[model samples]
Target: MSWVPVAVSLGFAGLTVLACCSFKVFLGVRRFGRELERTKRRLGPKHAALRDELHDLPEPRAARSPGDGVPSV
Candidate 1:
């Protein structure tokens, strides 16, 4: 019936809620990290190959042209 007990109960309730929320957030972060690692591993070689192919393509003539009305100098 006293204010002290009421305040203590409210504080305990707030702490319990915070603990549960923190635990859920921790689990979500762990799961996301694992998924990101998996995705990076799966894409690594494919991305490298694509980058190589892109590099092998011939350069565009327009991109190399100078003073051709394309804001060159």
Candidate 2:
């Protein structure tokens, strides 16, 4: 029938659009992931240093004297 060719053409067109859209999404996700990784790598050392410093700090005590200039809030 004449309608068969039209149906096949429409199906192929839909498939092509779907494929293109999927490819774009995949590429965008890949790019975003790479950017995130790079940012993490850039901040990794600083974060590690901060963690070490926090770990090395002495625990707070309840016997604070005057002139400590530290706020208890």
Candidate 3:
């Protein structure tokens, strides 16, 4: 039973390492989310302007018949 303490200590060390890695992953994801939000905010006005410009464009004229431009006899 003397090896039980050594096993317990190793288990604790493994758990500590897993917890640290999980915390670091959490921090990285949080930072990525913040960057995405910042980029959205920066580009929001340009996106709106482009949408408005697209809406303001005049529609295409209707297609003409093949002989529509010919003069009558």
Candidate 4:
């Protein structure tokens, strides 16, 4: 019946909405962290294999030529 009561109710509603959204964001972050950990665990072995394979590959050497700077058309 008073403006004061209406303002208080509106403020409470806003706070409730904010609290709900914050909770949702927290859940989302937690889920993302868990999924990230799972993905890393799944890829760990393959990642190591790739690293070992890469290590055994030939190393790159800079190409040097007697006339390297000169273009031969």
Top lDDT hit = 3
Task: Give per-residue CA lDDT, model 2, range 1-73, as digits (tens).
Answer: 9999999999999999999999999999999999999999999999999999999999997976776787777
Q: Give candidate 3's whole-model lDDT.
A: 0.98
Please tell me which predicted candidate would have the highest TM-score against the true structure.
4
What is the overall TM-score of model 4 with all chains considered together? 0.80
- Native-referenced Cα lDDT, model 2: 0.97
Candidate 2: RMSD to truth = 5.0
Off by over 4 Å in 4: 64-73
Ranking by lDDT: 3, 2, 4, 1
In the range 15-55, model 1's lDDT, one tens digit per residue, is 99999999999999999999999999999999999999999
Q: Across residues 1-73, which tens digit of lDDT does each residue of candidate 4 receive?
A: 6999999999999999999999999999999999999999999999999999999999987889778687867
The superposed Cα distance between candidate 1 and the true structure at residue 39, in angstroms, equals 0.4
Candidate 3's residue-wise lDDT over 1-73, tens digit each?
9999999999999999999999999999999999999999999999999999999999989999878898787
Residues forming the 10-long window of minimal summed lDDT in candidate 2: 63-72
* lDDT (0 to 1) per candidate: 0.93, 0.97, 0.98, 0.96
Q: Native-vs-model 4 lDDT?
A: 0.96
Runs in model 1 lying further than 4 Å from the true structure:
63-73
Show how many residue pairs clash in every candidate, following the order shown: 0, 0, 0, 0
